[model samples]
Target: MFAGWVQERAGETPVRPRDGRLFVAGEGRQYVLLTYTLKKSAFSLGAQNAVLPLLAQASNAARASVPSAEVIQAGVVLHAAAAGQQASREVHTIGVGSMIGIILLTWLTFRTFKPIGLIVLAIAIGFLGALSVCWLLFGRIHLLTLVFGASLIGVAQDYGIYFLCNRLRADPQMDSAQLLRRLLPGLGFTLLAAVIGYMGLALTPFPGLRHMAVFSAPGLVFAWLTVVCWFPALIGAQTLKAGPIARGYKSLVARWPRLTNQPLTLVLVAVLGGVTVLGCSRLTVNDDIRSLQSSPPQLVRDQIKLSKLLDAPSPVQYYLVRGATSEEVLQREEALKRRLDPLIAQKHIAGYQALSNWVPSARTQAERLALIDARLLAKDGPLSMLAGEIGEDAGWAAVTAAHLRANAAPLELEAFMRTSASEPWRHLWLGKTEGVYASIVALRGMRYPSIPVLGQAAEGLSGVQWVDKVGGISSVLGRYRAYMGWVVLGAYVVVFPVLFPRYRGRTWRVLAPTAAASALTLALLGFTGHSLQLFHVLALMLLLGVGVDYGIFMQEEHERGSDAPWLAVGLSAASTILSFGLLGSSGTPALQAFGLTMLTGTALVWLGAPCFIVTKEEPNASPVLA
Candidate 1:
């Protein structure tokens, strides 16, 4: 009875191209589909905002009427909204946690609330500069930029920390100007290195990485300016006595084994070098696009259920048919459907949908009409035989045949498209685009592995193109991952000229820790079976800047014969680890890869930096530290 009622109403204006099959269908039971159109694109925030209200109204109406009927929620808009909400929640949670962790680390490092305010002020200035510039340049900030920005807390604070550490070791008689002049070269060099690494990110065409680069690079510049221009005036002469932790760093650095110690250094290098090489050999790569962005599991399950129930064609993969006219486009689509029929017979494909399925071309419509007239409407045909069986007059058969012939008008594509029947499948008809008519033949039961075989169906066919969004994205990711790896290596070569002029023969001393740490980090990832990704390469670029900061600090302190640089380096590494370690626990795979790389790489840099410290007796110390 319910099916009968649905058929009566649905059949009144059935889904065109195929009639009521798309609206009402079932084997032994019944299923009804109600498609509600939204004003904005489903992925847009406006559409997502409207989804809940629509869902609520739909559920209420369904329950009030049938009570037992299931109101299944499915479609692109619904899943997109759920993914957006989940990502928002994660960003909030991770952002808050990273903030709290950084704040506590800052307080612990200085053991004063005053420096916390100063550091936070500097970080805030940097953030403002980055956000403002990003808005001006890109006109908007991506959520990914914000997600990547959380780690900037650790990086942006380095310049301020270096300035403040210098203050702790400065003479009480020294003014702010004297301190700024002394610290300028090291800070300047550090800024140059960091900018080189971040600018490399901007070179990529990927919008997410480009946004993050724009967000981070300018923020660092503004933060450095805050320290250089303002930090001295605020607290230049406010020197604090070296705390226990500072003294502990001093002791650790003093007792730490130097690479100048001969046999022991060689043994350590040989063992570690062997391990690094082994790990490098085991390195692999993965660039699957699905790992980059994931939807919520419940939404995924709901989508799968809806797809199974409807036997619907995939929206991501399809064939685009193009022609000079609407009729030509329809005729081309009909040809594509014919190519797909054998696959359907072999059970390799389930089914497909196209505009031609409902609105056949004028040529096809005329042929069908001619066949009907010839077979059933002839003078001595089935109509006359039926009339004879019913004992009707001979004139009755002739009258009925005349009525059928008069009513057999061809269904025009334009007339059908304008009707309510075409509302659900309107997306399949691209009546005019770029001076050509195009239409999509959406496919069902397609797999990525079968794409090459399936794509052959369109081969040698004019204006027919196979479109696979997911496959295309995955291929892009793989290409960029390899590109980024080369770019990271190029960053080192690019920074070499800058360091060579300043440090001269000692340049390798400054770059060694970062280079070694990056290699080992990759090796460690390999040993643990973690495939290399674009995120990992991105993190390595960041590590190049940060790890070099450590080496520069150590070398400068050795030159000045000051115990303060190790303390500064320790504090910097701790803060960095605190920020990125939180990211190691992130739900997002890309961020997790980035965080893990930084967490491991930074620790190794801290441990390896002391080996490069040259003492008075080791003036001619070998690069091997022997």
Candidate 2:
């Protein structure tokens, strides 16, 4: 009775039993079950919403030729209950712990009883500005954008310390206004360059990169303004005077001259360079999107469960199929599926979701309708009863004839349209072209080899073109690493040659130390079995920039016989090393990468300065002997 009702309402004939199962069929092909579900509770709404439309449309179009797809809404409530319990425990242990650590760091850095109050204010203002700018330009800030922007805590503190440090250095004879004038230009220039570097990332096509660029650029400016304009005004410069020397730091400075002139420093840096080179070669790029997520949330867990039950795997890789019409598109999709079948069988791929499995082309749909019509005609004994009173009436016959005439012109389905030529789905059989029309097939759990799978897949496809968009993150990071490496190298090459044109011959002296330091750091990482990733490469490049800056500063200071040069280098290195060194101790992988790179890079930069390389003009240039 249910089958009869479904066929009558759907304007199609039921070809099989009314059992609640997903079905797929084609002309001259038998119907097969794809998946099944059980009706249970309200939580099954996600599944119902996704599957109901396809089932209804298929049943209505196929008439009585295919069974209606069943709706299974069970199991979600139980899954949600379990997930909630797990989340509560994790929040208390991990989430609260991270919060406390962040708070403690903020307090120690600011060194004020009211540091928490000030930090809250700074965060509030910075977030407001970020949200306003993001909304105005991009409509929404992605979750990742907010997470990365929080890193401003580290970057912003640099500006704050610079301000406080300069304020403390100024002679007590000068007032606050004089102190401000002395520091503003240098601070402003540094902040401007930092802003420009971040803004450069916006040029990339990646959404995440764009978000980082937008949030960081403005946030840095705000931080600088806060430190220079607001922070000093609120906390007087007198409050920043160095306290009584700690025993550990005092002893280190007392031994500073001996440590600075040590011959073993060069040898140690050389050894580290060899190790870094080896580590660099072993580094792997992970493009997995899930790696960015902190952990799987409850929704993801439920989705995973549904995916397993429905035999519909979440796609780890996408296969894009394109054509001019629905039929052409489906044909291409089927062809790609055939090529992937072997990989699936070999367990190289878990499974795939393709449109060909759900929606057939216009030609195929028409052919199936023709077969159903022929079958109904062959059963003439029941046809009259099936047609009922409508078949005997002239008005009804005319209406049916007009309906058939309209459908004969080829039905236009929105699902078959493609947007662009470059996109997998470009061509459409109906309507004006707007966006590329393509179907994404999710690859099941497969251990994809490191080699290019898309190239091999493309080779098999021959005339049909296919592209993989999954590796976009790796590509972007790789390009950025390359660009930043060149930038750092160019900065050293150009700046040194221009500043010391006659001493350009000795450029390698300066570069050798920095290079050796970077190499040794990477070598240590590799020796420790830590594989360098994209972030590690980028961090190392930044370390090169910092190293070069220190090398230049130290070389210039040595030429002037400033007794305070060592002190400046020591303090500067201490500030950088302490901040970045702490970063290496972070639990987060990306933070640790940055920390390790900076820690090694700063130490090398300190040791690699051309102090010992005594130029021809100053052959007796020895701060130690003086």
Candidate 3:
């Protein structure tokens, strides 16, 4: 077919058979590429989950059919399926463990399951409301959003824990509503601060982060509302006692560093400053998307082998050609083909495939037909001369008739598309999109291909574009990382003013611990050789909200002479650490980054919150804080 098409150029037969074959190394070796077209609905999670097993079965069957042949499966669907499964597994395992730990901790501290019930109820309502809102707004929630949302188990329950802690310390005669009224200032500020922090996530252009922000902010709001509105009624005044565990926690709180002495404050600041400076100095950033979600090692190996064996270009990189009409699109693709030819010869790339390779332009078809007429079909051409020489008039007449028919009919892309031969390459012909005819020119087996060289190939050509998915996403990640850093700083700046009127001189105390914790977390990540990514910055955004809650709880409880604010703060910190710390073990690099940041940042906030407490010299001040 290839030889025949070479002789008869500008036909569909030559190009359709060998689509996306960027390179063919040896004459003896034969390769057949298989392409699958999925239904539009197959992209949804449920559909993808259903399709994955079938794909696996097909892969196994193909491998079994020919032991020597490699059947490597790849596509966006497969990648999404694997990532979804991984995320589900991560969320399930970590979520269950965190829940169990939180339950046991609550039970141990209070010696009752009532607080556990209330905490669980709050989280459930929060998560359900968030999911409902997400479904209403976006139609479908993303797996990443849920993964981050799982951390809300730690965060959303904080309001309840603080209420329960204050309840434990409340006067026996004090009603639930009275206790709630007393705690409202701290809890309300924490909620507002948290919302502000998450709003920063929503501000970013990154879809994943925005989804997470949307999921989280609503979850927090609902959780806080449940505690504020429902908890007083559900959690009516009950006899409560501080268990041994709670007493021990209180003892630890009693000894918390006040940082009130001038020398002590200076020394602590110097140490933190030195660590921050040194650690930040070592900080580096890596925004490559490959670092986020990694395929299984075996799958990675198979994909690499498949790409090398097939000399296939990066699936995510291609040229999109556009024109007013199909003919123009084909012409533009042909022009791109001309530019790529020299690069192929120079070994810059292995090869490329375009729609024009299979379906020639109308002009090209006419030219080829003209050549056929001159060479064979004309009266004095080869067919007539051969018939005159050999005197086989009937056969010569039949051959002449066939050539005339070939010249009379030109194969259009539309007609060729209806044939079975066009199935594999049909996707390349994007008939019309956004009022313009378009098609793709796929490249493969590029050797150290730079943006400059590849981009320049389409520079002089109109309606041609170089689209690099990986590069574009990585660039977006980097840009947003910078934006998120400022957003974090902005959250603090913005929240400080809101907090100032209420706390007045103590506003800095409420905000300072989180700022220090964020800096320290970044420094620690840098010192530990972890390159900062967008997700790390995102974690810091969450830290700003959660860490401030701890400071507010400590400051408010200190002012009110509560028995032990640290009990609630410590429990909140522990549960948060339990939830997010487990994320450090995640297979997804982004989740792992987030988990580590939260783990370190939350712990620092817990410790630092006590240091910033403004102590009073009067006897009315809580003796525990002395």
How far off is model 2, as Cα RMSD?
11.4
lDDT of 1 by residue, 230-325 (tens): 888888576455556665666686688777656776788889999999999999988877776666777778777777667667888899999999
Question: What order do candidates take by TM-score, descending?
Answer: 1, 3, 2
Output the number of the lDDT-best candidate. 3
lDDT per residue for candidate 3 within 324-427, as digits (tens), equals 99999998888898999898787777677776877899998889878866776766667776778887775676677586766588879999899996875777
Candidate 1 colliding pairs: 17-358, 259-625
By TM-score, the better pick of 2 and 3 is 3
Q: After aligning candidate 2 to the native by TM-score, how far in Å is the CA of 192 from where it should be? A: 4.8
Error of 3 at 84 (Å): 2.4
The lDDT of each candidate is 0.81, 0.52, 0.82
Q: Which of candidates 2 and 3 is the stronger one according to lDDT?
A: 3
List per-candidate RMSD values in Å.
Answer: 4.5, 11.4, 5.0
